[model samples]
Target: MPVDFGPPRVDPFEQAIELGAGRVRRLRSVPSGPAAPAPVQVRLPRQRAGNCTTAPVRRRPVRRPGVPSAAVASEVARRVSDRRPAPRLRLTRRGRALVRTVVLVALAIAAIAIAVSSRADDVTPVSSRSMVVTEHDTLWTIAEEASPSRPRSETMAKIRELNHMPDATVHVGQRLLLPAP
Candidate 1:
């Protein structure tokens, strides 16, 4: 049998009925009856583009008696007068070079810090203690209990070095050397 993966075909008549295509809605403008008045025409003075000589119209200040209105109006005027176009963000060649240099320097410093810290961590003296494994005891649990302050992996490695174990296997009641925190 052939299987179709695309959407099922829809009936055109059903789609049209669902979309209300069969319903005809007729709406007419409000009938202009005798109650409506006719519009009148008025002519306005036109100004020429090049030959314009009229002075620009100015708004008169609203004479408010209180200090608040005067202060608000003055502040609005000051803000409008002091308004300026914002500076666009465009980096110069020198700025781009400086950012690149800073990033490279930071990466170099991070690499050096990682190297120095790894060497520093290796130089630390490790203390060991002998502990007997009990029933249901694993190397991870032993490592965690032994060195609670340091990483479990580091403590496990230290325990393995102290006990000379090949893998992370230990027998119950077996004597093993563990690392101290």
Candidate 2:
């Protein structure tokens, strides 16, 4: 088996010098009529990108197959800086304005509906009665006088429900709003 060694290098200058010196020594011993043709210097044409006359647009090598990782990392960092809220969907200006207007109008509608409903309940019915209390007027006596057909306790309860009174006490000349008999 043979072991392989590295390649051997060759120098044209050494070969030419050796050949010329050998010829000179030989000519000293036996002179020649004419010297052989001298070694001609040859140059190799170097292939280079700079030498291209009409160079094509060289495209940059793709570092990734999909979106770049650096951009993704930057976006994630920006979101995390604000405590990593849920990823927000993108919206155009017109779409954002539309959403804002819709929310505002909905709130206004809710407020209006609440106000109208409250006012609807505030309208006093014609069947209800109001009495001005004289001196020594009590809620029980008034309930009995106001509703002779109904029970005194029941009338008092109805009066309390209507006038929002927690007790049966009444001040002198205090106008009391009573419910229907």
Candidate 3:
């Protein structure tokens, strides 16, 4: 089977209508009445390159009681005499001293608390009971016998430190100081 395609056609009538409509619109827009009025003439003052002219400003005269017209300048001067620059803010000697005192007091309070806690921890009570080692006696058995209230590990550490034992081994007839609970 073979496919068939139609041929394209260009129309001249549509182009002729568009050109005629544009000509008619241009002819109808031409002026149909009298001309407009002429603009008014305005002259501006000539300004020098160095001189600038400002708008006229009027200021009311300041009147003061018992003052002559010539004294107006002095009166204005007296009115603005008290307008001084603002004072700068700076810490005074007394203010600095107060701040230092506050810091010192805070540090003293912290130091006192630390000292009291350290002293309390250093004052571990020593036990009154002592143990005498015999043959084949272990530190574990001595700790159990001397300070039964304390944990076994704590009692062993105390016994080790008090007797200054190099090892866990103990000879016969050795004395061991027991620490308090």
Candidate 4:
């Protein structure tokens, strides 16, 4: 047997009876002898486009014997209007680029501000006294005279650093800068 990939065919008579094609269900009311109210048409919901098979139709609840029709109609209206579609945000390509550029600029400005705010402000003051080398004056004697309370080695290193001297060699009449006492 060949395989079939289509919806099963439904019998027309059975489908009609299932949809209550010839039926008129009336709400219970005082019966008038000669004339009866016209039957209300039951409209089935429309199927989506391109749909091949029929979907099940939902039936409305049967009104109770003593309930008023107006109340039922109001309840249905409230339910139908309860929910609404949420608002959506749609950005075009140019809008997205503009937002990206704004964010990058903001980041750059923030970085620059942080860099400017966090800077070093404590600068060591330059204060020194100049001295002329004399005959028989050695670096040790000069260090001892410059800082009597400090270590001789520390004072000697500081003197050498202040004068940019590589060693303890000094000539007579040569001028040298000494660190503050």
Q: Pick the candidate with the highest TM-score.
A: 2
Clashes of 3: 0
Query: For residues 58-126, what per-residue lDDT tens digits would candidate 3 score against the true structure?
Result: 234567777677566788888799688889878899998999999999999999999999999998676
Candidate 2: the clashing residue pairs are none
Give candidate 4 misplaced runs (Cα > 4 Å): 1-124
Q: How displaced is residue 170 in candidate 4, in Å?
A: 1.0
Candidate 4, residue 73: how far the Cα is off, in Å:
53
Task: Give per-residue CA lDDT, model 1, range 1-181, as digits (tens).
Answer: 9988544454222221111322423323343565533332222234355777776322344565655676688999999999999999888999999999999999999999999999998774656568899999999999999979899899889888888899999999999976656
lDDT of 4 by residue, 59-177 (tens): 45477787768867899999889978877988999999999999999999999887776653343344467789999999999889887999999988888887889999999999877
Candidate 1: which stretches are off by over 4 Å?
1-128
TM-score of 1: 0.30
**lDDT per residue as tens, model 2, 69-117:** 7767898988788795678799999999999999999999999999999
- Could you tell me the TM-score of candidate 2? 0.37
Residue-level error in angstroms, candidate 2, position 144: 2.0
RMSD in angstroms, candidate 2?
Answer: 20.9
Question: CA lDDT, every prediction?
Answer: 0.71, 0.68, 0.66, 0.71
Per-prediction TM-score: 0.30, 0.37, 0.31, 0.33
**Candidate 1 vs candidate 4, TM-score winner:** 4
